[model samples]
Target: MDLRSRIEASYKRIAQEAYDKGYADSIKDIMDLRFGGMPDESLAALREIKDVAVMRSIQNAALSWDRDEVLTLIAQSRSA
Candidate 1:
């Protein structure tokens, strides 16, 4: 599949897993961490079903970042 299709499919799978694992709150927390308080679009997206594939895709996307850098960005964004 193409990238977009893969992402959608991943999203669906991740969403389901999130629901099953009772990690809905965790997803919200991640969004808050990344977006500095969560945009409406992100919130709306999180409200959609949690699927493992999507969650993995998101995790993969973030894998390139250094953990410290990610934390720094989150901190800087929050302070902005």
Candidate 2:
């Protein structure tokens, strides 16, 4: 690929990795607060979320409540 195309591809990859890390961290926080370890379904659902802000919101929500409620909020956001 051309230099410009390579640069754009690299930027996209970096951004995607950062988002993935944020999502993983949020999932870990939720798991710790609820199940004390990662749960497959929750992890899968979190992977489906691409917005960092929404993932952060779910992490915040987990601080106050259980996993189901947090998942419900995420699902609602996805549908909207």
Candidate 3:
């Protein structure tokens, strides 16, 4: 699959698993399974988000939490 499709699929799978497990804190576990544990840079970047909506947008996307995307999203989220 293409990158976007892969991302969407992974997101769906993670969401389903989280729902089935009744786990609200499954984001880290999902990210680890989708992209191998979260990188330090990504974690640092995620720490910057202050808006719930923007943070949810990033969370809902299929995109992997690689360092650059993480930082970019966090920056955008803070601005939003």
Candidate 4:
């Protein structure tokens, strides 16, 4: 690829990573507040999700759902 294309790809990757981290952290924070902490399996499942849109949706759901429900959704997403 050309230098400009390479730079654009790199920037997009970095931006996506930032968004992932933010969404993951938000979910974790919600889990912590509701349940005191999150399960390791659930955290691992969250890490396995590479899609920013899925992560954002999970974060939004975590705000209201119980820990078990959130974990189940995360696991289902990973399997799908």
| Cα RMSD, each candidate | 10.9, 2.9, 13.1, 1.6
Tens digits of per-residue lDDT, candidate 2, 1-80, equal: 99999999999999998877777676676677676765666666677777777877787778776667677866776676
User: Model 4, 1-80: lDDT tens per residue?
Assistant: 99999999999999988878778888888888877888888888897788877877777677776566788779888899
Question: Comparing candidate 1 with candidate 2, which one achieves the higher lDDT?
Answer: 2
Top model by lDDT, which number?
4
> Model 1 — which ten-residue stretch has the worst lDDT?
69-78
Q: Estimate, for each residue in 1-80, the C-alpha lDDT of model 3 and write its tens digit.
A: 89999999999989866553332134445566767766565555565544455556556652455534544665665455
lDDT of each: 0.51, 0.74, 0.57, 0.82
Query: Which regions of candidate 3 are displaced past 4 Å?
Result: 1-26, 63-71, 75-80
- The residue-level lDDT of candidate 3 at 15 comes to 82
Alpha carbon RMSD to native, model 3:
13.1
- Evaluate model 2: give its lDDT: 0.74
- TM-scores, all candidates, are 0.38, 0.62, 0.44, 0.83
Clashing pairs in model 3, backbone N/Cα/C closer than 3 A: none
After superposition, the stretches of candidate 4 with alpha carbons farther than 4 Å from their true spots are none
lDDT score, residue 9, model 1? 97
lDDT of 1 by residue, 1-80 (tens): 99999999999988866574554355456545665554454445544534556544444433553344434443433344
